[model samples]
Target chain A: MMEPSTDKAFINLINQNLGIAYKVSQFYFDDAENRQDAIQEMMYQLWKSYPSFDGRSKFSTWMYKVCLNTALTYLKSNKRNKNEPLQENHYHLPSEPENNKEEELRLLELAIGQLSSLNKAIVLLYLDGFEYSEISEVTGLSKSNVSVRLVRIRRELELKIKQKLNR
Target chain B: MDHLEIMRNQWQGSGKHAEFTPFQENEFSTLIKKQMKKQNHIIGRYFWGTFLFHILIYALMGHVLIKYGIVSSDQLVLTLSLFGIALTFPFTAKLMIEFKKLAQVQRGSIGVSTIKSQVEIRYGILSRYFRFKKLYDYFLIPIHCAIGAVLSFHIFVPGSFSYVSFPIISVFVISLASCWYAIRSENRTYFKLPLEELKGILGDFDKK
Candidate 1:
C-alpha cells in the first residue's frame, strides 16, 4: 500500500497541510473524542485520496474539500455523539489565550454551535479566507448561493453572539 | 466591529485556524494506517455479520424441510418452500449488490468530491438498504408463519389436511401480526428519522 516515492511525497504534503484537518474538525466536532474521530477519518481519507490529487489546484484547497467531505459524511458516529460543551485542550487551538480573546472565542463557539453543520462549514470557510468560488467548489453550492448564505450567516451569527454575550 | 470583522481579524491575526503541530513522518503514516484499518473493519463487520445471520436462518429452514421428508410426496408444500427461498433471493442479492457498491464508494477516491455529493451518496446507499430491508421484512414475517403452519400440520397432526390446522394457523397469524407491528413501529422511528435528517440537510442547500 506504500510506494516509496509516492508515499514519501504524500506524507510530506500531509505534514504540511495538517492544519486543514485540525481546523475543520475543531469547528465540526465540539468535544475531544469526536474531534479525534473526525481527525482520524479525515487523515485516513486524505491518505487514501492522495493519488487522486491532480495538482491542478493548490494542495490545501484539495485537502479542504476532502476534510469537509469527510466531516459531512461523518454521520454514522455523529448520531451516537453527545453534544457537549467546548473544551480548551486541543492539538492546535491554544490551551490558554488572552482573556478577551478567550471570551470572544467562547461566545463565537457558542453561537457557532447553534448552526447546522452545513452552515458551520460554510461559515468556517468564509472566516478562514476562502473565496466564494472555492467555497462553492468544496460545498457544491453555487457561488451565488454561497454569497447569499454568507450574508445571512453573518447576520444570524451577530444576533446569536450578541444574545449570548448579553446573557 | 461586526461579527465577521472580528472573526476575520482574530482568525487571520492569530493564524490559529491554519496552524498545527506537524506530525512526524512515522507518526503520520502509522496513525493513518491504524485509522484506515479500524474504519474499514467496522463497516466490513456489519455487512458480513448480517450476511452470516441470514445464512444461518436459511440453513436451518432448509434442514427442517428436508428432515420432515417433504421432498417425497407433498409437492405443494415443497413448492411453497422453494418459492419462499426464491422470493428471498432477490432481496438478498440486492443487499449484497448495495453493500458492494457502498464498499466500492468508500474505497474509491470520493473524498475529494464536494460535501453535498458525499452526504448524498452516503444517504442514498443507506436509504436504499433500508427500503429493501423493510420490504424483505414484510415478506419474511408472513412466510415464516406460513412455514410454521404447514410444518405443524404435516409433522404433528399427521394428516393430509383438516380443520385442526385452523388453530395452529390462528396462532401463527397472531404472531405474524405482532411481528409486523413491531417492525413497522421500529422502522418508522429509527429508519425514517435519520433519512429525514439527511433530507433536511439537503433541504438547507435550497432554503431561502
Candidate 2:
C-alpha cells in the first residue's frame, strides 16, 4: 500500500507521461478499441507494479519497460484469437483529409504494424529517444543485440517507406 | 535527413494529430482496483485448485494402500502403487516449485530479464510435463490391462498362464498405438505452435 501523498505523486508522474501510453498503444494496435484496451491494460499493470519503481531510473524509462511488456503480452494473447493481416487500410489512420504529412505518417504506422513484435518494440524504443543501453535495459536484451536489431529495423523501415512512396 | 531520423521526427509528431480520449483518473482508479482484484482471484483459484487436486489424489492413494496393506500378495499391484508414489512425489515437488515461481511473478517488482527467464523456465517445465504425460499414458493402458489379466487369472483360472488374455492384449496394443498417434498430432497442434511463438519472442534476447 502507498501513502496518499505517494499515490498522488505517482498519478502526477503518469499524468505527465501519458503520452508514452498513447504512443505505445497507437504503435502496437491497429483499431481504436484494441488501442484503448492496450492502454487500459498498460495503465493497470503500471499501477499494479508502481510500488516496485525504485527511483534509480527515470520514471519514463520504467514506464517504457512496463508499457512495452504489457503491449507485447497483449499482442501475444490477441494473436491467438485473430490473425491480423498487414494492410494499411486496417489501421485507423487519422480520419481527416490525407495531406502529404498524414500520408507519410500513415505509411509509417502501416509499416510499423507489419514488423515482427520484437522488432516493433525495438523501433518504438528507438524512436522514443532511448539510448541503446536503455533500450537493452527495458527490453532485457544486450546492448549489441539492441544495436543489431535497430540497424535491421531502420533498414526495414526505410525500405517500407520507399516502397509506399513509390506506390 | 536519414531515413531513421525522418521516421523519428514523424513519430514524435505523430501524437499531435491523434485525438486520444482523455483519461479520467477516477474511472481509471476504479478499473485498476477491479483488475487487481480479478488477478488476485485468478491466482488464488489456480493455487488452491492445484493444492486440492494433489491432496485428493494423495488421499485416494493412501486409502488404497491402507485398505490393501503395503505388502500385498499381489506383487504387481504393490509394485504399481510404489511406482505411482515415486512419480507422484517428484511431480508434487516440481509443482510446488512452479507455484512458488508463479507467486513470485504475481508479487511484482521483478526485472524484465527475471520475468522472461521465469516464463522460459515455466515453459520448459510444462513441455517436460506434457512429454512425461504422453509417455505415461502410452504405457499406462497396457500396464493396467496386464495387471487386470493377472488378477483375472488368479480369480478365474488359477495356476494358468499369467499373461494378459488375447482380447485384453489386443485392446492394449490398439490403445498404445492410438496414444502414440494422439501425442504426435497434439504435439504439433497444441504444443509446438505456442513453443515456437515463445521462442520467437525469446530468440532476440537469446542472441547475446
lDDT, candidate 2, A128-148, per-residue tens: 778899887777777898898
> Over the stretch A82-103, how does candidate 1's per-residue lDDT look in tens digits?
6443433322455455686566
- The TM-score between candidate 1 and the true structure equals 0.83
Docking class of 1: acceptable
* Residue B188 Cα positional deviation in candidate 1, in Å, after optimal superposition: 7.3
lDDT of prediction 1: 0.72
Instruction: Quote each prediction's TM-score.
Output: 0.83, 0.71
Provide the lDDT at A101 for model 2: 65
Superposed by TM-score, candidate 1 places the C-alpha of residue B72 at a distance from the truth, in angstroms, of: 5.6
Which runs in model 2 stand beyond 4 Å of their true positions? Answer: A1-6, A73-78, A83-85, A93-101, A131-133, A140-151, A165-167, B2-4, B14-29, B37-79, B82-86, B104-106, B112-195, B206-208
Q: Against the true structure, whose TM-score is highest?
A: 1
Root-mean-square deviation per candidate: 3.9, 5.3
Report the Cα lDDT for residue A122, model 1.
Answer: 90
Task: In candidate 1, list every pair of residues with a backbone clash.
Answer: none
